[model samples]
Target: MTTSLAPDPAPDPGLDPAPDPALARELRRERAHHDACRAALARMAEDVAEQVVTGEDVAASGADAEVLGRHLRSRAKEFGEQPPGPLFFGRLDREDGQSHHIGRRRIAEHPAEPPLVVDWRAPVSRAYYQAGAHDPQGVVRRRRFGWAPYSAGDTADLTGLEDEHLVSGEDVVSAIVAGEIERPRVGPMRDIAATIQPEQDDLVRSGPGTSVCVQGAPGTGKTAVGLHRAAYLLYTHPQRVRRSGLLVLGPNRTFLSYISEVLPALGETGIRQSTLDEEIARHEVRAVDGEAAARVKHDVRMAEVLRRALYARVALPDGELALADGPLRLRLPAEVLAGIVAAVREEAPPYATGRERVRARVVRALQLRAERRAGPLGGAWARRVERARPVSAFVDACWPRTTPEEVLAAVLADPDDPLLTAGERAAIRWAKPPRSFRSARWSAADLVLLDEVAGLIERPESYGHVVVDEAQDLSPMQCRAISRRADFGALTVLGDLAQGTTPWAARDWREQLAHLGKPEAEIVPLTTGYRVPAAIVDLANRLLPELGLGADVPAGVSLRRDGEVRLCRVADVATGVVEAVKGALAREGSVGVIAADEHVGPLTSALEAGGLLRAGGDGGAGGAEATGGTADVVAPESAGERLSVLPARMAKGLEYDHVVVAEPAAIVAAEPRGLHRLYVVLTRAVSRLDVVHGEPLPDYLAS
Candidate 1:
C-alpha cells in the first residue's frame, strides 16, 4: 500500500482557510473523555490507598500482614502511575454501533464494570491496529489521535484526529502516526503502544508459554517490542509472572536506562531492568580479558570441561573397611561401595546433589548390613551409623562437596589438564594465581564461567519470562547463563544479526537460540524500518552481506521517505563533526556524535573547543540544567539532554534524530567485527545521517 509522508502542512500567514467545525468538535469531545479517564484513574488510586489488610486477607495460621500490606501498596502505585503524554490513542467502532477507546492501559469507573478505555493488548482492541479496508474484523471505523510529542500533563496537547471508515472502504494515510514515528528521540525512550504495527502486535501478544526470537533490522522497533512483550506478559499473567518473576536484559547499563521509562509509561512499575553484565556479576571485574583468553573462557566447550573437572574431584575407594561396634564387628565389601559411586555418577545429579547422594547410599548400605547382622535393630541404629565417625570419615574423604570458585580455580591452575590445549590453558589461567579465589581478580568472561559452574552445583533461580535485547551478540557461554535463569520459563529474544559486533556473535539465529536452550523458539523477522529513514537503512543494507549473515539476511525497507543522508569529506573530521552537530542542534532533535572508542575524547574536545558545552558524567561534565549552557555535548544516560557523544559500542541499541559519524574506516579497523560496528552506528539516525570523514568510506557504501 502506498503512503503519503509529506511533512505537516505549514499554515499560511497571508490566507486563513475555513476551519473545519466537525474536527474541532470531535477533538474537544475526545479531550473531555481523556480528562474524565484521568479523573477516574485518580479515584481508583485513592480507593486503593484507603484499603487495609486484615485477618481476612491472610490465614489464621499467622501469615505476615507486612507482606500483604506491601502487595496492596504496590497495586496502588500501579493505579497512581500516570505518565505524561496521550493516555488513549485510538477509537474503534464495532459493526453493532459500540465504540471503544484503546490506550496504553485500561480505564474504568469501577472494578466490576466494563472499561471506558480498553487496553491496547486486549483481544478486542486488536482490531484498532489490524483492521483495514479489506478486513474490518467487526470494526466499522477506527479513529487515530494526534498529540504533541512531549506534553505538559494537560489535555491541551491533543491536537488532531483521523478516522478510517472500513465499511466505506476508506483507506487512511495517517499523518499523525507517521509524525509520531518520525519524532526525534530526546531523553529516555518512550512507549510505542499507540503506534504498534500489526506485525509488532503479533509478537507482543505472543503466549506467555512460548519463547520467540526477533531478528529485527536497525530501527525496526525490536527493543521496544521486547519491552512491550514483557509488559504484556506481566499484565496477562500476574501470578504466573510474579511467582518466579520477569527480567529484562539489555546490552549495557546505558541502554537499560534508555528504556527504563517505557514499561513504567505502559502502567508497569517496579519491573527489573538490568544489563547482562550486571546480572552475572559473581565478583567485581577488576581485570580485562585478552582476546584469546576471552574466547577460551566464553567457549561452550568450557562448560563440559568445568563439569568434568568438578565431578573428577570425587574419589572412589579401593577397598571396603570394617565398622566396629562396642562388642560387634561389621565388614562390607569394596565392590558394594564402588557400585554406589558408579550409580550416583550415572544418575548425573548436580554436583552438590551427587555428593549427598553418594553419602546417603554409603550410610544406607552400612545400615542395611548392620540391621541384617543384628537381626532387626531399631531405626536409631541407622542414625547412629550415619553419625558414626567411620562412616562420616569415609563419605567425606570420597564424596567431597566444593564451591564453584574452588573448582574453577583448580581447573584453570591445573598444568596437566588433557581437556585443554597448552595455549588455551595458558591464555585462561591466572598469571599470579592467588592463594584463594576470594582474593583473585576475575575477568568478565571468568564470571560467565563461574556462573556455569554454579549452575552445575544447583539450578539458578528461574523467571517466568525473560527478555534479552542485543541477543545476536551473545556468546555461547553467555547464552548458557541466560538459559539457566530462564530454564523453566520462556525468553523473548531481540536483536539484529548485522548489528552484532562481538567476536563470538552468532551468524544464524538458530545457533543463538540453541545456545539459549530454546532451539524450537520461532525465529521472527521484522525487516520494516520505521524509526530510521530509508536512506540510512539503505546505507546499512549494503553492508549486511559482507558480515557473513548468509544470503537470506533480508534487507530492510524504511517506511520513511523523508530521511536525510549526506557525506561530508573534510580535511579535519573533528571540525566537520562539530559543524554537523551545530546544524543538528539548530533543529529540535537529539544529536549524537559517535566515533571509535579511542576517538571519543578528541571529538568531545573538538566540540568543547568549538564553543559547545560538555554535558557529561557526574564529575566530568553536566546536562543543560547542570551546566546552564546551550549547545551541550551530552552523555547518553543524561535525561532531558539533546546531544550525546558516545563510543561506537554504546550506539548498539540507541537512536537519535540526527547522527554524525566521525570516520567509517576507523570504526572498521577498531575490531574484528568493525564492519558490523560501522553498520550499527550508521543506522542510529532517525531523520538524518552525516558521514564526516578524512579517510575513504567503506567499500560497500562507497560503491
Candidate 2:
C-alpha cells in the first residue's frame, strides 16, 4: 500500500497542461494523517490534565499525598503545551508490510490501538537512521517529512516528503538530509535528528556501561553525538539514569548558552548542564592566578604534595595525660601516651575523625585502669573523665583538626617547608605572598585543588554518568576530579587533541583516559567534517603538523564545495575586521569575529563604533566580565544578523555560518599553544571563512 506522487512538469506555451491527479491525492492523504496525529496529541494532553489529584485526596493522605500531587501538577503543565517543531519527522517501512512514524515523542489514541507516532529512541525506529542498501536490516523504505511553520492557533503543517528506498541499491544520502543541513540556523544549536549519519548513530546506540572517548576533528559532530547519547541512555535505562542522575559539562558559560536548547529540542529536559569550574567550585571566586601559577596548581603531582602536607599535622604526644574526677583518677606517662597516639595515627583515618577516636580511647583506658586498682567505676564517672580538660587537651595537641582551606594556605605560606622539595617549592610557591590567609586568591585551577583535598578527606558522591566536552584541555588533576564524580559509572569524553589550547593539554588519549579512571574505554576517531565546508577545513588543517597530528590527518568532506577562504592583508586590523563582518552580515545566518585575547577589547570597540554590533544590554560583555579567564562575547540574540566577538580560545564548540579571522600571526603568538588555538578559530565557519591580517602570517601558514 505505497502511495507515490507523480512528478509535475510545466505546460508548453501554446498548450494547457493537465494537473497530476496522483500528486493531489497524495498531498490530501498526508494532510489528513497530520490532522489526525494532532487531534490525538490534544486528547492525550487533556487526559493527563484531568487525572490530577484533588485537594480532598491530598488532605486525607497528608504530606506524602501533597508531594505526589505537586509532582503530578508539574507533569501536567509540561504535557499541556506543544512546541513549534514538527511532531513526526520520519517513517519506517518494514519488509513485513508494517509502518511506524518516528517522532520526538510517542502518541497513541488508546491503550489497545497502535501508536500514531513512535518515539525516536524506540527500538523500531533504529532503521530510520541506520538502514542502508548494503544492510537493509528488514527495512524497505524510509520517508522523511518536511514541515512548514505553524500559524497561530493552528496545528503543524507537513508540506512535502522525501523517501530513500533501502533495497533499491541507491546511496544513503537523501534530499531531506541535504535540505536539513543547509537550512539557515537562526537561534541556538538545534538537534540533528533528521540528519544523523550512520557512523554517529553507532556511537549514540552504545551500551550504558561502556565509556567512550571521541577524538573528533572540527565539524565532525561530536557535540551532537554526545547529546544524542544522553537522550538514548535516558530512554534505554530510565530507572538507573533517573536515580543517579546525568550531567553534561562544557568549557565555559558562553559555550553552554550556545548549546542550551539542543537537549530540549531532542525531547530531553531534565539533564543538568554546567561548566567544570561551576561544578567543582560552588561558591563565588573573585581573584585569579596567572598562567604559570595555574599550570603548577593543575599539575597531578600537586595531589601528592598536598597529601604529605595534610598528614604532616598528625604527631605523637609530647606530654603526659593526667585526668582526675572524684573516684576516677588516671595518670599516663609520656612514653605510654605517645604509643596510644601513634597507634591511632597508624589507622590512617581523616584528621578530624582521628582526633575524636583518640579522645574516646583515652577515656576508655582511664576507666579500665581505675576499675582494676579500686572498685568498678560507674558510667556517669567515666563520662565526667571523658569531659575533663586534661584529656581534651592531650587529644587536641596530638591530632589537630584541619580544614582543606587551612591546609592549602599553610602549604603556600612557607616557601621552604620540608614537605615540599626544593624544586617543587619553586614551582608551587606564590611569587608575591598574600598578606594573610583571608587574602589568598584562588584561581580556576586552585578550585580543582580544593576539590581534590575535599575528596581525600572524604569520598565524594558519584553520578550515574558524565558527559565531558572539550576534554583534551583538562589537566591530569582536573580529569581525576571529574572521574571521582562518576567513579562507579561511565563517561562520554569529547574533544580534538589538535584543538587543546591549555598549557597542560593532553598529549595522548591513552594517558588522559588513565587519569579519568577509564583506562580501558574505547577510543573512537571521527574524521569526517559534515558541518564545515572543505575549503575552510583545509586552511585550518595547515597547523596539523605543529599539533603533532602527523601526515595521516584526515581531510573533512563537505557536500557544498562552493565556500571560499579569503586571505587579506590590511594596514589597520580593526577596520578590516569591521568591513569583513559587514560583508558577512549582509549574507545569511550568524557571524563571528575571532581575534587574539589582547585584541578582543579593541575589536569589540571598533565593531560597536562602526554600528555593526548591537549594543542594548546583551550578554555580549558578560564573557569579558567573567573572573579568572577570557571568554567569547555572546550576543543576547543569536538569530538573523547576530554577531559575536570572540577570543580565539572561546571558539571551541561554536560555529557560525560565516567567520572573519583577524591577524593570524597575532593569534598564534598569544600563548604557548596559540597555534592550536588559531586552528580552532579557523575551522568554526560553516559556509565561508575570511582571513584578514595586518602583520605577516605564521611561518607554517605562510609557507
Candidate 3:
C-alpha cells in the first residue's frame, strides 16, 4: 500500500517509446489495471448470476415462486451486462501511504489481493476530488486519467493522465479541466467525475442528513453535482436509500432525456428521472391551459382555497343511526351521532380518513346500545346490527366518498361555492365549467392541485432523497407536491433564481425553501462557470437587473475565455436561425437553435424546407409538431446532424457547444416572466452564443 510521490519512471531505454515515455508507461499500466478490474468484475457478475440461479430453485417451491423467479432473472440480466466506460478516472494517495483508484463502481480481486478500483463514493476517495493546496487532507498528489472516444466491443481508451501536487503548492490549472469542459458534445450528458471542481465536489460529498439548496449559475455544474450527490448517497447509505428510493426531477421531458445518462455513467441505475408534470400527473394529460389560467392555478393561495373546498364535503347526519337484528333493535340518537362526527372532525385527519373514523364510531355506538338493552348481546347480534341497511345509509349520507379530481371539478364548476371567498373564487374559477367530470380538461398546473388534494386524502409515499433541478420555475404548490414525496428525507434543490421563467416563479430562494418545507436548508452559491465561457455569461448577466435578483445575481468565471457572443439584427428570424444553425453545425460539437415556443414551428419548417435540418424522433415533440403540422427537428447524436431546434422554455439545465437564440423580444413576450426566460436562453452556450433577432431585443439587452 506504499504510495509514490515521484512520477512513474520513463519507459525502458531499449523499448521504442510512444511520444512521451512517462505518459506512455502510465497509460500502459492503467490499461493493464483496467483489464484486471474488468476480469474481476466479470467474476463478480458470474458469482451474482450463480446466486440468482441458486435462489431460483429455492423460490420455485413457494406459492409466489413465479414472481420471485422473474425478479431474480431481471437482477441476473443486470449483473451480466457490461456498460461501456472507463474502469477508473482517478487515483488518490492517502496520508497513510495508501493508493486507491476511483471509478464509477467498485472492483476487487480475491480476498488476498487488494481492491483494484474503489467506488467514487468511498470515504478514502474523497481526496481525489476535494484535496487541494489549501487543504490537502493528507494527500500528496492526485492523478486524473483521460479517455478516448468509446468504440463498440471495447472500453474507452485510457490515453492520457494529469497530476496535481496537493501539498507542493504547485499550480493545478492544466488541460485536464479545460479539455473536459471543451470536450465535444455527443449524445446525452456524460458524468463529470473526472472534472468535478473542488466546489462542486463539496456539494456532492455533503452529509446525507443535510439538505442543500445549490444556487448555481449556468455551466457551474449544478445538475451534475445534484446527480452525483444522488449516486453518492446511494453508495454510502445503500440500505437506507434503497428502502426509501431516490429520484431526480427536472423541468421537462427533454431536459430529463438530456441528463438521463449521467447517473448510469456514474454506475448508478434504476434512479427515477422525471419531469415535474410527469411526476405530478402520473398519467397522460391531453389538456392545455392558457397563461392566465395556469398562473392562477399555480398560485400559492390555491392551497388554502383547495383545503376549504375538500373539507366542505363533510357534514353531520340529520337523523339517528338505527340498527335492527332478528330479536334485537338498537337506536343511537341524532345528538349522539353528531357528537361522534364532531370528535372525528376535531382531529382533522384526511377527508377520506375522517369518513372511515365516522363509520367506525357509528358501529361502536350500535354495539353499546344493543349490549345495554340485552345485557351483553351475542357477537352474532352485534355483527348483524352493524350490517343493517339503515346504518349504511346514514354513514353514506354523513360522509360521501370523493376523489381528488371530483373535488377539484366541483370547486371550479361553481364560482359561488361556500368554500371559495371573493378573491379565491375570482382567481380559480374556470372560464367555462365542463358539463361533466369526464369532459373536464386538466392543465399541467392543475396536476399540482390534483397531487395536493391526493396527498390530503391519503399521504403520499416518501423517498430517501429528492434532487429537484430547475427549482426556480416550480410554483409554491408544486414545491409542496415535491416536498411531500421527501417528508422524512433530505433534498438537493438546484436552480438559478435569476433563471426563473414562469408566471409564478419564485422571487427568492428563501421563499422557495419555505414552500418546499426546508426553510432551514443551507443555501450554497456556485458562481464559477465551467461550461459556458465568461464572455457569454457577462452578456447574459445584463438581463439580471431586469429580473430583479439584486444581490443574488451570480458572478461567473470561466476556465476558458475563448468564446464568442454575437448579436445580429436580421430581416427575417427564420432565415437568420437557419444560417446560424448551418454555421454552428459546421463546428465540432452539438448545436441548438432556441426560440420562443410559438416560433418553434416556423423555424423548424424553415430548417426542414431548406434541407439544413432533419427530423429526430426521440426529442419530446409538442405544439405544431405534435399534431404533425410541422417538423420539430432534434437530431440524435448518431444521426450525424448535431443540431436541435429547442423551444426556449425547454432550454433550462441544457447546454450546447454552440447556441443560436432567435428573437429575444419574442421570447420575452411569450410569457409573464419573459425577461427571465430570455436570460436563461442567452447563457445556454458552452463555446459560442449567436443571437438572431428580427425584432428589437428586450430593453435590458438592447442597452
Candidate 4:
C-alpha cells in the first residue's frame, strides 16, 4: 500500500533534469484526493444550509422553529468559515485499518459513512505524532503531504509527499519533517498539526479532567500545545465545555493576537482569549504602581489581607430586634442576634452567602416564635415576617452591602493594619484619593487585589477548562484570579521559569501551581528546541545560571543543525540595527528587530528613515496596532512587511525566522530581571540571531 516516489534524476551538462515519473504520478493522486475531499466538504456545508425545520410538529410555537433555524444557520456558518488549506496533511497506514488520512477538521461524504479525513485531534491519529521505527503503534507507514499557497484545490497546491516505513525499522529523518519545521513563519502563528512531536502530543492529549503544568523552554511549542489542548477538549467534551466555557489567559494583548489565528486554524472558533488584567478589571487603569508598591500588591499574603479587610465589615447587632407576628410583637435580644451571626460566620461560606444564611436563620427563629404563640402558622405568615422593615434594617446594619472597589479602597487607606507598615500604606495609598469608590483610579496591581475581594464576596463562576500561558511571570495574586475561574475544573498551565521577567515572577512551578489551586497537577518539562535552532539555544544557555535554572539539568538542546549566530559591533546602534534588519529582510521568512524599551523609539525613527516600517501614514498598523499597549509594538504585519520591531519584553512569546537584538547591555539594564528578558529575546530566532550592539554585550552573553 505504500507508494514510494523515485529519486530525482541527475542533471545533464546544460539541460534541465527530467521530473521523476513516480513523483509526478504520486502528486497527481494526492491532488485528486484533495479535490474530492474539498468537494465533499462543500457539499456538507450545502446540506446544512439546505436543512428544513418542519413547522407542522410545532405549528403553535414559532419559538421552536426559530431556535431550530438559528442552529442550522450556525452550523452552515461554521462549515463555511473553516480555514482554507490542504484537507489532509498526514496519513497512517495500518493492517487493522484505523485511519484514512489525518486533517484539521474531519470531512465526510455522507452522514453515516467513515470520514474521508480524520481530525488530527482524533485518537487514531496519535500514531502520526508518536509512532516511530522502534514503536510503530500498529502503523506500517506514515506519509506527510506538502502544501502550496492555498487556493481552493488549485492544480499545484498539493505538490509533494514523503513517507517513513515504520515496519522496516528505518531511523532516517524525513526531509518533509525538516522542511516543515524550518518553513518560513510569515503570518500569525499557524497550527502545528503537521509537525507535532511525540512529547508535545502527550501534553496536547492530556485528559479533559487532568490539570497539567508545562515548563517549556524557548521554541518548545508550549503555546501551540496549550491552544491545541483547548481544541482537543472542545472536541472530546463538547457539551461540558460548551455548558461551562473555555478560556485562555495570556500575558498581554500582543501575545493574544499573535496566537489568535492558531485555534481558529485548528477549526475552533469563538474561544474567549484574554489577558488577566482584562478578566479582573473592575475599573479603568488610570494609575500605575512603582516597583515596591507593585511587589506588595502582588504578594501571596495580599489574598489573606484582602479577605480580612472584607470580613471586617461584618459586625454583631448592637440591640434587640422587634418582629411583628400576627398582631403580636416579638422581641429578640441582642444576645440571640449575636449567636445567630456567630453560627453563620462559623460556617465560613462566601461573604454574600453568610449574609443570606444569617437572614434566613433570623426568619426561621421568628417563625418558630409565631408558631408557638398561635399553635401552627401558614407559609403566608412567614412571608410577612420575612418582609418586615425591622428585619431588613437589622440585617443591613449588621452585614452591610459592599463592592470589591469599596473593600480595596478601605484596605489601601487604612493605615492601622499590621500587614502594611506606615510607609507601605503611604506608598500604595492614592496620593490624591478619588471622590469615592466609583471614581477611583485603579492600578493594574489594584485590579488584581479587587479580584481577590470579588472572589471572597462570592465565588467567581467556574469554567470547564482554562489555559494560562506566560504563567511564570504571574504573581501569586494573579494566579489566584485564574484559580477562581477554574476552581471546579482543569487547567493547562504553560510557561518557563527562565522567561520570568516580572519583579514577582515565580521561581518554582510548585509554588505557582499551588496558587492556581492545582498543587498536584502534573508538571511536564519541554527543553527540546523545535522552532528555534541549536546555535541560538546554545547562546541563550549562558544566561541560564543568571536566570536561576540550576546546572544539574541541560539548559536546552535544539534538534536543528542549520542556524546562524552573529554578533556585530558598530559605532552607531541605530544605524547598526537598520543594517541588520535590512540584511535580514533579504532572507526568507519574518524578521524581528528588537531593542530595549527606551531604545524602541529611536530605532523606529531609524527604520522609518531607512524606508522601512511604513504604516501607510496612519491608514493603520494592522496586527501590531491591534496588540494594544502591552509593549511598544511598532511595525505592522502588512503586505511585504516581514519585519516586526518591538521592545525586548514584547518578544517573550513571539518567534521569528531571523531576529536582530540591538545593544545587549541596554536590554539587560532596562529592568530588575533584564537578564531573563534578554534570554527571552536571544532565543526567539528560529534560524538566525544577529546581536548588534554599540556598547559591550552583557557579560553573560559576551563570548
Candidate 5:
C-alpha cells in the first residue's frame, strides 16, 4: 500500500543517449531488487516473533535477530538514529491464521526525508511492511509512519504501546543525530549535568539513579514535567519504577492539593506528595526521644518555637511554671481544667529573673495559700483566677519573660543599647513575658514541651523521597532535619544560591549538602527561568547587580514582551497599593499579591476597594488557613474572591497568572535580609509581574 510520487525527470538531450529504452529497463530491474529485499524483511519478522513468544533467544536461532539487527544498525548508521514506529515487523501462521506484536514507536529527531524499512513478522510490524513497494525508476519508495506531537489520541495510544517500544531516552541516543523536523522541547532538562542530559531521559526510563534532581527555574514546567516524567517512567518500565518508588514534593499541603490530579489525567496513578517542612515537623513532633544536640543554645537552638507557643497558650497554665498534681488545683479551675494532672517535674532550671522568678514564686505561694484557705470565697476566687491564668499565661508566654526588667529598662532607656551583648539580649528576647501569677505561675517550665515535639522523627520509613523546594531560604539545622527523613528513599534539594543569606554557612550550601551524602551527590542548578517574561527577567538581572551584590539574575531569563519596571512612589502605602492592584487586575482572572509579612490588613483593604482580590483563612504567616472569600471583580471580600494577596515570605515555590509585589520599598528598608527576599518575590510570576512601591526600592532593585 506504499504510495510513490516521483516527479518526472528532465529528458536527456544528447543524441548519443541511445539507451533510453535500455535505461528504462535497467531502472525496472533496480525497483525489483528493492521489492525482493522487502519480501525477505517480512520473512525475517515471522521468525523473530516465534522465538520471542517461545521465550527462546531470537539471536540464538536462525537469521531472525541478524536480519532485523542489520536493518536497524543500517538505519542508525545512515539516519544517526532510527525514527520511532514499527522499525521491523513479524508475520506468524497461527491457528487463527494471523499473529501480532504490539505497535512500538520512538520520539526522536529525523533529518530530511527518511525512508521506511518495515519487517513483516509481527501483526503491527506487518501493517507497515504489507504496504508494499514501487518500481518507480531506479529509486525505491515507501512511507514510514513517524511520531508527531503527542495529541489526545497519541496519549491514549501510549497506554497500549508495547513495553519494548517504550524505551528510555538513555536506551536510544545519537550524538550526531540529524533531523529536519524540529523537536518539541520542554521541562528542566538543561539544569541537569550535560554528561547526563542526553541520556537522562534514558536513565529515567530505566530507573537506575538512586536520586534524580530536576532543578527547574520558575515556570519551566519543573512540576509539570516532573509529574509527566514520573508517569512516563512508570509506564515505560512498569517493573522497575512504580508509584511507590516515586514521590513528588511540593512547597506545602495546599501545593500538593494543587497538582494532585496530574497523574490520573495521564492514565497513571498519582505518586506520593507532601511538603518538606511538614514532613520534618511531623518527624520532630511525633517521634523524637533523645534530647536535642543543644539543650539550650541561644541562637543555634533546635526547638520548634511556633509549636511550643501554641501548646503554652492552650494546654498549659503559666507556661514557665511546673508543678505536681497534689498542687495542680492552684494552676487550674475545676471547669477549665482538662483533667487532674498526676505529676509534673522541672525539665529546665528556673528562669533567671522577672516572670520566671515570679512564676516559680507564685506556684509555691498558690500551693500554700490554696492548701490553707480551703473554704468557699477563697475557693471561688482561686478558681476564677486559675481560669483566667491560661489566657494570661498564653499572652505572657509569647513575649520575653526571662529578661531582668531592670536590664531591659536600661536597654530601652538608651536609644543606642550597644552595651548589651547580642546573645544575652536574644535569650531574654524569646522568653515568655510576665503573666498575672495570682493563680498563674511565673517559672519557666521544663523543656518537656520541646521534647514532645522532637520525638516525631524516631523512624524514617514513612516517606519515599525528600525534596526540599526553596531550600536556599532554609537554615543549616532545618536542612539537617530534612536530610534525616530521606531514609525511605533518596533526597533531591532545589535552591537558588543567589537567594541565600547565611554569611558564614549559607555561602557554601554544597559543602553543607555534603553532610547528606558523598561529594558526588546528585546536585543540579536551574539557570533558566520560565516564570517571568524575558523583558522582566532581563530587567531584574540588570537591576540586581546595581545593589552592589555580585549575583545577577541568570542570563537564561527571557523577557518575551515589552513592559515597564518602573518604581512609583505614592502619597502613602494605601495609595501605592491601590495603583498596584489596578495594574495586577489589568490581566483579569486570578492574580497573586505577596506581602512581606502575614499582617495584610492594609494591602487587603486596598485590593478589596480596587475589586481585585478575595481573602482566605487567617493562618498567620506560615499557617494553613487561607482566609476563604469570593474574588468577584465587583465585590472582593475574601482572598478567594479577590486576587491572591499574600505576604512575600509565604510566596515561595508558588506561581500565578499574574503577580503584584506589594510594598517593595518597605520590605527593602525593613527586612534584615531584604535583598535576597525581594528577588525571590519578584521571581514568582510565570508571565506578568509587577512591583508596587510607596517609595523607591533599594538601589539594587531599582537600578
Candidate 6:
C-alpha cells in the first residue's frame, strides 16, 4: 500500500509562541501512541483471561505478542518525549482515546524478527524487578546497603552469651539488666525494583495480626515474604523479635537447603530448620519414651545344641524356636518361666545366668541358620515352645518349681520333647549370626515446638521471630510443634491453601492451630504471581484445579505474553523421551523429568545410561557428575530417581525452568495423593513447558 504524503502546515506567528510547534506536534503524536498502548494493554489483559479460561497458553497466540510489544513501545515514547503535553491530557476522553504502544520501534512497522513481547509489568517476567515502582521519586532514592558479609563466629558468638556470669550487687545487677543491650545486626538490603503491590504490603504489615495464613500461589514469593517479614519484625520490634527465637518447620532436607540463606541475607540468624518426620521420631523415642530401646535378642543356645545332637535329622534349625522348645522339654516351673519373661520385660541385653547363657547361644546359633531359610515363621515357632504346657499336671507343677540349673538339665536330657512338631527337622548349622541394625537416631532439634522439647521455646534466650514457610505442607502435628516452641517469637506462616501437600494431616491443621490459641492470625492472600511467564501461570491456574490441585487463583497471576506452552507427542514412550530431551536443550531450560515410580527406573536409565540426559536430582543440569556433560543431571540421592523422573508426590513445593512429565497416562491411575503430586509437577514450570509421554495430559490441562 502506498503511504500518503501530506504537505507540512505552517506555524502561525499570531498565536502564543511559548510552546514550540514541533514540540506540540511531538506531544500530539505521543498522546495518540499512549492511547493506542492503553487499549492494547486492556486488550492483552482480556485476551489472556479468555485464553486462560479456554485452556490455552497465552504465549501460543500471535496477537498477544504483538500487543505486548506495542504497549512497551508506546510507554517508552510517552515517558521519553521532550514536550510531555500529550502525556498530561486535560480531558479524560482524549487520554482514553490515546493508543499505548510498548515496542521501542514504530507501531507501523512489523516488530523485529523474533520479537521480544514480554510484559515487564507481568509478575512472571524475569525483568520484573527492573520495572520498579512507577513513582519517579522512589526510583532515584539513594541505595544505602550492599551484599551481606559472612563471619565464622556469628552462630557461636550469639550462643556464647549463656556462659556469662551476672553481677550480684543490687545496683550493678539493675544497671546491667536495664541498660546493657546487644548491638543490632544489620545486613545489606537489595534495591527492590518491582513495586511491592500495595495490597500485598498492607496484608503483610498489619499489626499484631492474627496467625497469618498467606495462601500464596506458586511463583508468588511466599517464602521470600515470610523471610522479609522476619526481617521486618526484627527491624520494627527488636525487643519482641530476635534471631535465636525464630524456628522454621520445612517439608524436607531439600527445602531446608533451598531457603537456608534467606534469613542470613536479611542480617538475621537463629532460625531452626528441620523436617517433620525427623522431629517426631526423635521426640517419641527419646524424651517421650524415656527408655533406651534396643533390639530384643533371646537366650536359648544350649537347647539348640541338645536338639541338634539328639535329633539332627528331625530338629528344626530355627534356634529361637528350639530355645522355646527348651522350656517344654524342661517342664520348667511356672515361677521359672515367669523369671525369664520378667528378664525379657526388663529388656536386658544379656540375661543373668552364665550356664544358661552358653546353652542359649547354641540354641540361637541353630535357630538363626533355620530362620534364614524359614523366614519370619521362626519367631512364631519360638513363641509356641514358650507357651506349651507340660505332659502331666504334676509335671507342670514340678517344672514351675525347678531352678535354672534344673531346667537346663531337664532340657538337655529330653531332646525329643513334646514341643517338637512332627516332620520338623532340627538342623544346627553354626554360621555367623546376623547383627541387628541399630535404629537410626532421629533429632529432637526440629521438635522445638513439641511440648516435650524442654525449655525450647519457654527460654528467654530463644529466637524472636519464627516463620513457617510452605505452611500448607505442615500437618496438625507439625503446627502443634511449631506453635509451642515458636510462641516465644513472632510467627509468620505462608502457604497456598489450594496446594496443601500434606492435606492428610493439614486437613485439620487450621482448626488445630486455632485450638492452640493462635486465633488472631493475619491471613494474607497474594493474588498475583511474578515468577512464570503469564502464559505458563495462566495454564497452571486453569488446569491445576482440574487435576485436583492449587486454589482458585485469579488469571492476573499469569497475565504476560512472552512465554509459550506446548504439548509434544512422541511416536512411542522412548521417542517421547528423546523429544522432551531435545526440546529442553533447544530452549536451554533446566529440564525436569517427572514420571511414575514404574517409569522412573527406565526413564532415568535411558536418560542417563543412554547419555541422552544428565543423572542428578532436582536442582538443574549441573546436578549430574562428569560422566559426560551432554546433559547435566541434578538429582540428589535421598530424593532418588523418582524425584527426577517420578510423579508429583515427590515433586511438590519445587520448580524447574523446563518440566518434562514423561508418563502422563500413569497420572490417571494414580491415587488421590499421587494425583495431587502430579498436578504439582505440571505446574512447577517457569518459561518453556511441555508434556510428553504415552499417557494423557492432566484433565485440567487437557480441558
CA RMSD, predictions in order: 4.2, 5.5, 5.1, 3.9, 20.2, 26.4
Lowest lDDT 10-residue stretch of candidate 4: 8-17
- Model 2: lDDT to the true structure: 0.75
TM-score of each: 0.92, 0.85, 0.87, 0.92, 0.47, 0.46
lDDT string, candidate 2, 1-703, tens digits = 1222323231111111232566446557766776788888889887777768453255545777776777677557657444557778788889999999888888899857999989888889888888888888988888876554222213324445666788886554555556567554445677888778888999999998999999888888999999999989988998798679899999988778777777777666767999888888834686677666677778887888788777787778777778776655678888877777788778977566677888888888787788888878788876787788898777767877676777787777664556555766776677776877567787676778888877767668788889999999999999999998888889999998888888999888889999999999999988887788788877777778778766333545565555778898899999999888778867756677888888888887887787666444342221122222222323343332357776787777777778889998888888888888898899888887889999987776765
The lDDT values for all models are: 0.80, 0.75, 0.76, 0.80, 0.40, 0.42
- Model 6 poorest ten-residue lDDT run: 157-166
After the best TM-score superposition of candidate 5, give how far the Cα of residue 642 lies from its true spot, in angstroms. Answer: 6.4
Question: Better model by TM-score, 2 or 4?
Answer: 4
> TM-score of model 1 relative to the true fold?
0.92
lDDT of 3 by residue, 76-146 (tens): 66565546767887898776898889888788876467889988888888777777888898988788765
lDDT of 4 at 401: 82
Which stretch of 10 consecutive residues in model 2 shows the poorest summed lDDT?
A: 8-17
lDDT by residue for model 6 (1-703), tens: 0011122132111122243455445434444544554454345445545544444334646887666655454444333331211111111111123222122121221234221222212222212122223322222211110101222211111100000111211111111111111101111111121223345554445443334666677766676666655555554565554425546666766556556655544334545666645644533443221111100001122233332322222111111222234322222334543444344324422222322332343334445554565554456664443343422222233112222222222332343444443222122111221231122222232232223222221222334545666666554435555565555555677766556644332443356356333656655567666555677776666644553333433333743344667776666775677566655655433456776666766776777664554555332321221111123443332222222344455555555666777766675456555554554666666655777766556556675
Cα TM-score of candidate 4: 0.92
**lDDT for 199 (candidate 6):** 53
lDDT tens per residue, model 5, 269-306: 53567654444442133222112211222123323342
Which residues of candidate 3, in runs, are more than 4 Å off?
Answer: 1-20, 59-75, 111-113, 150-156, 282-287, 325-328, 368-386, 417-435, 570-579, 597-611, 614-639, 694-703
RMSD of 4: 3.9
Candidate 6 TM-score over all chains jointly: 0.46
Clashes of each: 0, 0, 0, 0, 69, 80
